[model samples]
Target chain A: MANISQPSQGAWTRMLPNSAAAFHRISALLTLAILVIAFSFASPAFLSVNNTLTILLQTSVIGLLGIGMTMVIITGGIDLSVGSVLALSGTVTGMMVKAGVPVVPAMMLGVCMGAACGLFNGFVVTKMKITPFVATLGMMLIARGAALQLTGAAPISQLGEAFGVLGNGALFRVVEMGDNGFPRVIFPGIPYPAILLVVVAIVASYMLRRRAIGRHIYATGSNEEAARLSGVLVDRTKLIAYTLSGALAGVAGNVLMSRLITAQPSEGVMYELDAIAAAVIGGASLMGGVGGISGTMIGAFIIGVLRNGLNMGGVSSFIQQIVIGFVVIGAVYIDQLRNRR
Target chain B: MSQTLQAAARFDAETTPLVEMRGIEKHFGGVVAVDGVSLDLRPGEVVGVLGHNGAGKSCLMRILSGAMAPSRGEIRIAGDVVEMGSPQDARAHGVETIYQTLALADHLDAPSNLFLGRELKTRFGNLDDKRMLAEARKVLATLNPNFTNLKDPVSSLSGGQRQVIAIARAIYFDVKILIMDEPTAALGPSETAMVADLIRKLRAQGIGIFLVSHDMHDVFDLCDRVVVMNKGKLVGAHDIDEVHKDDILSLIIKGELPTDWRPRNLGELEAAR
Candidate 1:
């Protein structure tokens, strides 16, 4: 009996290759390749190392938030509160640093503040059983109000130089700065913070796809009742996914403040839309049980290029919004098509 | 003749009952789904539960597996009364249920699905991919050695492969009692045979199984004892050797054994139908 069953099981394993993972990867790669080709044709500067690095630098913050968005979406949830959390975290981080608090501790406090806001959203969505869309929407309003009230609706500037350096500074050796004499391409000019984006993507993808906790996220999204029946802590996984998303958004907010040298109460308004768009474009199903960090990273870059390319081509900001709107719709349509099977 | 000898070989000589449920009752919004349903699952015993739709077979299993809270009941594992307020509670008490849908995440691979909801993480909070993949191979080898494509996502697997993963997951968790709901409902002949072999192997390992199946041939082929329920009430339990297929069907549909029931060969039963 063992011998008979062994051959049959081998036949079972030989018959199929588990196409969904491959399909997911292929879709992401296809999107990346298309984006690269389109941008390359649209502008000569798009392929240049300096401009490419600029896109990477610009996408870092969105990429950070996109990782969290991917996890949340994978668990069949959303975090509309991210943008508000970002602004609030930025306000607190900026205030603390400006008040002579140490930079590291202040950054920690800012992230914690974002996590706390996420906890509220998670508790409401999970414990209270509110729909994710509505729960996070309420959180979005509360976070926005808190930011406005704390800063009196004003942009706080003159943040410490240390914090500013984290956003804009890159470790590089300047060979020369002359326009004609050996135009010095700054060696290792990629922003250190930009590397942080790549690292975040790799780590987040590993956790979501490879780990046991990652499997739970997928199971939870696939069927909440089944997952709970399989001994999964369904409510806890959701809470963690939402909290991580908010915390990442907060980190993105700090990165923005570091770059701009100010904590604007309205800095990240509507950024949640961009983050969600990135996750969707990267193959995350709005219904859940799909998505990864690498796809989201590419998605963030695609958005950055769309915005930057339009700007460089002299398109008005209003037109940029129209283009982004069309792109988001097109991406979601393609996602629906891919999901039809 | 050889198959009957092998079938008898499937049951361990020193079998012991692993899980028992008594007086289990569950209700949903003024409707009594399960009431006064009791079952005993012994090691190396495949207990076939037959019932019509809405006859509370699922509700009874759900209460036993802790998927739903029972308004009143006692579940015991190894002679100790257990309260399964949630599915996790049942799991901790060594109970696992595999639903008809398989409940696998289509986007994830077999190893990932096998370890869903209880992943092994490294001390640094990273996924231990190598360890997980290795353990997946080891577990599938022991439970269903024919399963080999550990890296493939579940959606791409055949019907049999998916079922194998679901069963492997239950076995991997060291579940002493396995409850399967309509496991072979949609499989082809070859796939169904594969599942039958898996069930036999699980029984050989001293695991008790409560199989909820509509297939009478499956019950005769795999089960040691048959329990029948009709309209949320238990009819009776009979050892397969003492009763025949018609006797069990009569119990399932009519809630009692037929007065003139007699055992018949599989070919004769099919011919009669």
Candidate 2:
């Protein structure tokens, strides 16, 4: 137990992702570092302490979602219902708070709402034998419609200021003072959203690397029939993957609701695509069975850093989307090329 | 205590067969895939089953391996009646199978594939990866000393190397009755020889092997007895010395022993026919 999590042997320590995947993992890391460095040079404001924290906070939402997407993709399944589930969960939490329920429990119910939507997606995909793309796509519409109906298409913006603790509220402050006792380079401190993202990332990575179910997820994705024949409960493994994905999306929704201090039914539309892009750019294959949480976090930061740098460099907002799209395609292309060689 | 019983069981193959399947039948809708048939294999014996496509060989083996439920049958392992509802149940009864597809998760490395469902875990139930690695390394070293791609995903391995991984998985756990479907169908000469060596080694260890094969050479070289099936019934069963390769082929192609065939001991063959 004392030696738990240690890499004991040499070649045996090389571990998962194989050699090519290891190369891809490192390449992704280098890509993120290069983005941060290049962006810092491209815009003088990009390297500032204030802007760096902002980039991380902006990354928190999509990065959290990407964690769940990575697990689903590892099993060769996709959860397109993430964005809608997030909106539905957030709306429920906001409504509960507005109706005088406690914030903590209301938020818990909000996250549970996301999990319930995900559970539906799982049942539809597994018990009903529907393909994940179609199943989650159906869920995507169903959750969105539910959120819209509940909110009557109006955003909930009047939640009390006491509800602000979950979003932009600082947990620990980091600030630098000038010689005249005035704050010179003020840091936003570590916000609630960033803290949530860190906790989720650590748990997700630990599960992926150290759990039996995690290994089963890889096996089920790599070759499902093989996993089934090996006595792996394939259906149950898939159910858990979707549920975890939904639970994380729930976490994301609460973070976003906290950040805005409002629940907008229209919020999180197309955010699913961003989450998938982050996982893919981090080296997860759409074909399934290849990716890591660390890579995904870096991938999210790459997107965040890229957008911020572009904004400060006076680039058109529309060009930013085009650039991110190119990066996603290029990342997959490079991975395929490595495999071919 | 159980090890002693297993050791005693290994020597008494002459008295009790390791696997006994009685009145196995499989029906698909109105069609009968396998009619009433029985098969048995003793410890330290290798039996080969041969048939053309759709002759119900695969269907029968699927039931025996716990991949499919028989419409009706009794499967007895080590002289005890057992109900095997899944591959996991079959394995618990000491029956292990290697399919033609090899059934490997191509993206995982050898150790992960070897312990797919049965993983080594710490006290907290997290995967005890270091211990699993050591165990996999130990078992694999005995199988293929030159197998060095332990860290690479199985998809990157060669076909022979992949077969080694599959075989390692089957034998790593405790096994009594081993079923192999077309072990040499996908391998070249050297790899085929490698699998042949493994078969002989398992037999020497007192494990019963049911080799489902189309290759007459593998049938002749490895099996003590050969069984042929046609139209969902046992066409013929023969000792390797008492039968010719062509006779086995004719039984597979025509589902019957040739009209002018001679039998040294007509007891088992005549009874089956």
Tens digits of per-residue lDDT for model 2 on A1-341? 54653544433435434477777778888888898888877777888877877887889999989999999999999999899999999999999999999999998999999888888888988899999999999999998999999999999987877667778876667668888999864557777788888999999899999998889889889999899889999888889889988988888988898889898888899989999999998889888889889889888888888888888889998999999999999889978867664
The B-chain TM-score of model 1 reads 0.84
Worst 10 residues of 2 chain A by lDDT: A9-18
Worst 10 residues of 2 chain B by lDDT: B1-10
Complex DockQ, candidate 1: 0.38
Going through the candidates in order, what is the number of backbone clashes in each? 4, 0
Name the lDDT value of residue B151 in candidate 1. Answer: 82
Interface RMSD of 1: 2.3
Give the Å error, residue B212, model 2.
1.0
Model 2 lDDT, residue A300, Cα: 89
Best by DockQ: 2
Q: Which candidate number maximizes lDDT? A: 2
> Which stretches of candidate 2 lie above 4 Å from their native place?
A1-18, A174-185, B1-14, B188-190, B264-273
